[model samples]
Target: MITKGDGMGGARRHGGRPDLVRARVQQGMSQESAAQALGVTPTTWARWERGEQGVRASYRPRMAALFGVSAVEVERWIEGWSHGETSSWPTTDLGDSSPAATVKSAALLWRLEMDPSRRHLLASLPFVPSALGEWLVSWNYGTPAASAARRGAGRVVGLADVARINEARKAFGQMDQRFGAGLVRPVVVEYLNGTVAPLLRGHYDDRVGSELMTAAAGMTWMAGWTAFDLNRHGQAQQHFGQALRLAKTGDDPLTGVWALAALTRQAIHLEQGTWAVWLARAAADTARRAEAPPRVMSLILVKEAWATALQVKSAEIRDGRRAKQVERLLTEAERAYAKGTTDRDPEWTSRFEAAELNAEVGVCWRLLGEHRRAADCAEAAVTEFSERLPRSVQFNQVHAAEAYLGMGELEQALGTARAAIPVTKALTSARSVDLLQRFSGQLEPYGDTVAVREFRDHLNSELIA
Candidate 1:
């Protein structure tokens, strides 16, 4: 019998029998089948049925389809209320970036990331910080700083071991560049937990320990970055935080600053413009404190400019003052780039060359409402993004498309979007997928047109297939 109740009150409205369970039973499907259909774990499905978790409203349509029920029926079944009884479930999204929550979430991520099998369990974990914070304390909050005086008493480790680890780290970085983070995160995480963790605990002298810790910290940063690329923001936050702690422990200020810069990128993509600015400034300040080489400093400055551009584009008051500040930051970035040579910077900064810089400047201008310049810079950057950086090319293509859309060049936007589709399709970066999704949303107004519809269809086929 279908039980109905007034669209008020809690799960008690249906005597604590969640409609999710009822719907599934009615459809004659087991939890495993439902989970398989939804592409989630059976455990996750159980939680939903038991009311231990709430389903994202965006997922409702698919859930409804899977359960062989109308979307309205699923909604009524889950909430024990009819339409208009409450706000949509999306309003209840638990993801937020308060400082305390961020730290707690990062710590949890550090644990979860070490166990690949348990990583799936993270989907059930409550909201973690969606991005990293700027403060030095943020990184060191949950973890202890490594001390130089502490020496491992196991088998003695030497500079050769540390060098090998760095080499492995570099190799993983190259893989990520060519194939995207989704393809490389597992390998990186395995290396960290399997190989690097052992070396960290092995016997080493003071100097070797410092180098080893710093190397480990660098790998951690890479892990965090890969997580971010894969759209695992909380995991990314935790990894970066871990890396920062390791950097401090090893007394490697440069790595710590770079970790902060990575966090800034997270904030920017997560649309926390204010947080992005804060993190970027912290990175620059940290660099200055360490007297970082001009090349590294220049990279940090550009990151700040990028963050500032995000702020200006997203702010209610997009006036000349904000625009000028963005320009000033960009000018400083250019000067730094001019003054510093790549040879003086770390291997990591090698990828942030002229092409990358141009792409950033283009994106900055686009966000600030300078569509013409943004398009030009973006187009040029696209040409400069060689095969070495597959994901970057895909990312810049989306930027180019956005510029065209802003300038009302619908055909150009559609064309550019289509070209970027295949590039993003093969890559596992969640940010890359998000960019395409956002681009699709941007085309919704013009979706009635043949070109726009064709592009949308192409996108849907690629993503869904």
Candidate 2:
């Protein structure tokens, strides 16, 4: 609704880690001086620039404001630097909000996600890393009682905060912020290890606290999804368990279904197809019994269909038929979505969408060697997903890249993959990174080529930048 881009003039992250460090140098700041200011080593900073390390919390703010340029602006620059592109779509403004305006500007910022030109608006604002970390504490039970109370009035509104956190978390999930797993995985881990559990155990009402615990647990599981996406299987497993407990505490059946479906998908991704189908079936059953919304049920079915397709090896020829049928099912579910039907429907139907199902099917088809169909399905997914998810439009880009690569269009694949790099810089989810990494790994054979190399090098150097 509100578009603001020009104000981002000084809000660039310098376009890559190397450029950031270089900019500090250009400003005449010596390595020692820079390290002292950010509280890190010259070597550590260099490694970060090289994408060898995660961007530490302590350094981001000071480094971002160093040249009177917002760290976000530098992050913007890093995308172009990483992908070696002069311009990219994801670097647009996310509305006209300043760092302090984030909580107030949530809705406007949400809308900015679709407006590609204003995409970088959020990143441009130098978020106080400490604030971002503590923001969760308000909703997370782990925060000290006084601290949580301080944020809220007398009693903590953990329930409401949990719901609100879910809102942010979904957008975060949809965006899969990082193009690679290295940066986002740790951020999620930090959130999980630090904020989520404490919130679950913190004092609150039986009803409100239960609901809040469910939300936290669900979000906690989401952190695992990020972990799984990042290939941190062990940590992801632990998170999933934690999510289950929290979901149960809240007596939220939908949350349970969410975790189970994730497990099913993970099983399929790991090639344990049988387990995938079994898990999906169990999840679906529970979802059906529990009265989730229509949308949620659709999502669960979509997950089941995809997992089923993968598990059906010998039945592969007919897999296409099943996939088509799944698409139809989701459409039906969508029609029922706005009717307040989810409160009446099965528990698993709350978060379903045709676009997401399409994306899932596209991946399943690609894995099944149906390249032509995969391309078609992926293209559709990219269109729908991008329309719905502005902040993380790049998620579907990975599937699109895979389809392009699978179709043997090297340049097209490379182009799409390269395009994804810049868009991914602002995201904070390991899931997005995992998808991008998959696409990049596919392009690794193209590493020697100029395009691939540029993308690789630029992304590697984006940490500090």
The candidate scoring highest on TM-score is 1
* Root mean square deviation (Cα) for candidate 2: 15.6
- Candidate 1 lDDT tens digits, 1-465: 223322222232323336777778888999999889888789867766766555554566688678666655666776666533442221111132222222233334444455433354332222234334334445434343334434444467889998998898898888888888988888887777677766665666668867876787788788878878877665676677666766666667788788888888888888788878888888898788778887788789888988888888887876688789889988888888888674547767876788888888888999898988998988888788766687888888889899999999998888888888888888877888889999899887897888888888889899988
Measured against the true structure, the TM-scores of the candidates, in listed sequence, are 0.75, 0.52
The models' CA-based lDDT, in order, is 0.72, 0.54
Q: What are the runs in model 1 whose C-alpha is more than 4 Å off?
A: 1-111, 114-117, 123-135, 138-149, 342-344
| lDDT for predicted candidate 1 compared with the true structure | 0.72
Error of 2 at 223 (Å): 2.7
The candidate that achieves the highest lDDT relative to the unseen native structure: 1
